[model samples]
Target: MGTEGGHGHAIDTSIPSAARMYDWLLGGELNFEADRKACEDLLEIAPSSRELALNNRWFLERVVRFLARERGITQFVDHGSGLPTRPNVHQVAQEVHQGARVAYIDIDPIVIAHGRTSLEVNSGTRFIEASMTDTGRIVEQASKGGFIDFGRPVAALYVSVIHCLKDREEPAAMIRRMREHLAPGSYLVICQLVSDEERVRREVTELMDQGTDGHWGRVREKHDVRRYFDGLSVLAPYLGDVTHWRPDSDLRRPQKSLEWVEFGGVARIR
Candidate 1:
């Protein structure tokens, strides 16, 4: 198998990383012990986090298919692309459009390591080790690397990742910068971990911040997430629970609850 870097950095298993924790929650084997402990602590506070993560992942797959197949978008940039699991962004998008190009960006060492290995063999994709906060460089690199054509309609995805931004990081502004770079026909797909309960939001955010050793972002309300799409046109089933966004008939929900659900949608640039 093609590979990039392999565990180049010292594996700091003392503290958790949102990426690894998420991998664990999704039943992936890329996580470390710190990730498991952090996830356990989160479960104590919000028992539905694992379920929410799974649903959000499914939501991402749905958006990729919709954009590649239904909307005919061929270029994609998945911000904060964690460790690659089954049916990754490029895999899903390329399934519908073989010419699809995907650029996965993330600063986490593990993600970068795994991304390099998982994507090196895919001709239409590449992995960039960068922070979402560095939108200018990301845009420049993506354009110069020949993976993305800003002149064409590209689907930029921020699935379940915005919460990793602290308020000072200006996640919205970064997205706005990216939006300004896209063509009118392009789409921006954004979703984040959300909760209507203030207590749930506060505790989980605080705990995660601690669990990750301050490498965490705060969770925002559902409305705040919607604000990112203010000028765009949202598609059908607008901004409901992600599981219901475009669920497959075979994927049965064994239980239903909305305490912590994926809430976001696809919006076309106007």
Candidate 2:
């Protein structure tokens, strides 16, 4: 973490970060030139990269809205939260349930820096900086925050973040730990970048790894993502491309490649 001097926080421009790259993909100005260049290179290989980002964001909004409005779930925990983008989880949930409380968690210093500035003031929102691997610590901190009551059904979101984990960390195990903490009838929303085309996966993974100085994770196979939902009961539509999973019509669009897209689904703890 390289400091910009005032916020006592470091903004490292030397290594490209996924959050920054995502900001670039979404046309935000919070990223460095390295992030932009990496996004461009990724686009050259995966032309639909930007669209994929938008689609995934849409999925997040829809899931939050559903939990708040339809299911009467007022507590949300967003893990691996990226930069503070428009219509974030808190915004969407609060619209449906004004008293909805949300806790945003992320390991990146940039996320924490921006979160403190943007989210800390909201009465029902708070941001905590921590790695996804520290599920116990995350749960403990969130429990102390008073916004999220683990004793009740809480929505735990892992949207578009699991791919950041390597096999050694056992992303599935992390999910299981969170599940063990949630009350029955809770919800789990997950999605990860996936592709059936090996060449597409290899090229995108290699290019991103190089450009970001190995900060990115491998693009997984579709089935591998589905397996993450093993213990939970999947919602009616089961898992598929992120764009196709109960997507809003306005956000629905055709795919540019037959290779793959972000894939996963929502499930309930039965």
Candidate 3:
């Protein structure tokens, strides 16, 4: 468990945080009453939210295991990595290759606090506090002490966090910047909240924005997420509900709801 972060901000229990809300949805106890209430409101808008979160989490694990075990990807950079959970990226990757390295990046105060406390024993992993879109600093810090080798292949994972960016924040541009830092054999694992129903998208986006005080981005359509992977070589089962993204054979996942989904897939940087 090794950890370091750029920020030392104290956790504010009065306001809602996307990371904490997500923790609450995952049945984790690192959240405050505010986050729990916010999740309750979110459930009203999208009844399948808990199911959606679980599926997205499952997708993350499935992809990480597949990349480390099957593709021989030994290093992983997890952007916007929320509160620590079971079978984290480092855990999954290390299972395949004991020396595998992982860097967890997130700007949330609570995430940084809990991460530093809980992940202090793993020497091969790091928890960095910074905006995932902060390409320059993230690239710099993740590279320190040979934490991650830019010369070697790596997996840059956005997972379900890109939706936290506003349009002006240019999530795609951030991806492009990170892609520029990876080797030809490296890969990008991305996914975000998307919906086919316009109403579902509008309402959820609005509610989250208000709940987090504009710390959230809009829910987009499938095509919107597709554009993020413009030049990357997408793996099979390209861009759809994450629930169906190469599901595990031994494990049964929850079914996807019609209103919205966490959508995206794995893509090679080349």
TM-score leader: 3
Alpha carbon lDDT of each predicted model: 0.80, 0.80, 0.84
Using Cα atoms with residue i matched to residue i, what is each candidate's TM-score against the true structure? 0.94, 0.93, 0.95
lDDT of 2 by residue, 1-270 (tens): 111111124667867788888887777888898778878888887888888887788878888988788899999999888888899888999898889888888877787888889888898887877777788888888889566899999999998888777677788898999999999989999888888889888998787667656556678898788788997899968888767776666746666665658888999987
Per-residue lDDT of model 3, residues 6-51, tens digit only: 1247666877888888888888898899889988988888888888
Q: Measured by TM-score, how close is model 1 to the native structure?
A: 0.94
**Model 1 Cα lDDT, one tens digit per residue, 61-90:** 888998888889999988888889789988
Q: C-alpha displacement of 39 in model 2, angstroms?
A: 0.6
RMSD vs true structure, all candidates: 3.5, 3.5, 3.0
